[model samples]
Target: MDSYAIKYIGLLCLLLAFVSCKKKNQNSLPETMKKDFVTINYAKGFSIEKPASGITIIKVYSPWPDADEAFTYALVPKALQTQPQLNEKEFDAIINVPVERIIATSTTHIPALENLGVIDKLVGFPETRYISSEATR
Candidate 1:
């Protein structure tokens, strides 16, 4: 072979080696490890502890009427009485008392009480048809 042909073949081999090496390095990362990477925002001077896989966050209204009713109904179960920060333009925290017995007068109140697991604490009702099954009747 001519010197020029040999030099051209050598250059082609070098280029192919570099391209294959680049591809191998890119694929060296495990797919699961790459997929699990997440971005988190932290407030100034705050750091987060790594969360467990099944941990969940739910946004709850702070100091809701149900919270008050729960408070009045049974002195506020420790799990439900957390005072969350309120949005100044929309809602405000009015009361922090423990609830025991709820007297539901409006249609909306019964459903709210039932969802909080305090349906049995509903001792009195004004309008009855809205409630299912005349059990309370």
Candidate 2:
């Protein structure tokens, strides 16, 4: 074969190798988010992706009325179980699994959080008097 043809074939092989490596990396879970997790069906403004073990990435777009900014939160599931050995730098929030403590600002979030059995995690609410939850009462 001609030298030019040989060089082209070598380059093509290298490109193919690079592409395969990238696909493999994308398909493999990162060390932090490898464990099992529940799928969250979120609204239009938010989406989730698990790229590693014990971690979840949340993307929020225009989450607030009249707001134009988008934000991201990297959450660690069963945080207490993983946080001891986890690199905290990998996540934006490290809420304990079966959450134990929380401060609530809106009653709107109560019912869903309560139904999840994690409402007990609320230790404080700014409007305690407004809350009528039988569990909290």
Clashes of each: 8, 7
Q: Estimate each model's TM-score.
A: 0.30, 0.55
Off by over 4 Å in 2: 1-42, 78-98
Candidate of highest lDDT: 2
Flag clash pairs in model 2.
Answer: 32-53, 32-54, 33-52, 33-53, 33-54, 34-52, 34-53
Compared with the true structure, all predictions reach lDDT values of 0.48, 0.69
lDDT of 1 at 35: 28
lDDT of 1 by residue, 80-116 (tens): 3564432333322223234566787876676666677
Model 1, runs deviating above 4 Å: 23-109, 119-137
> Candidate 2 on 1-137: residue-level lDDT in tens?
99999999999999999988884346765575565434656547667776655456676777789987777666556643644655556554555544567788888778877888887778888877788787775
The residue pairs that clash in candidate 1, if any, are 71-98, 71-99, 72-98, 72-99, 72-100, 73-99, 73-100, 74-99
TM match of model 2 to true structure: 0.55
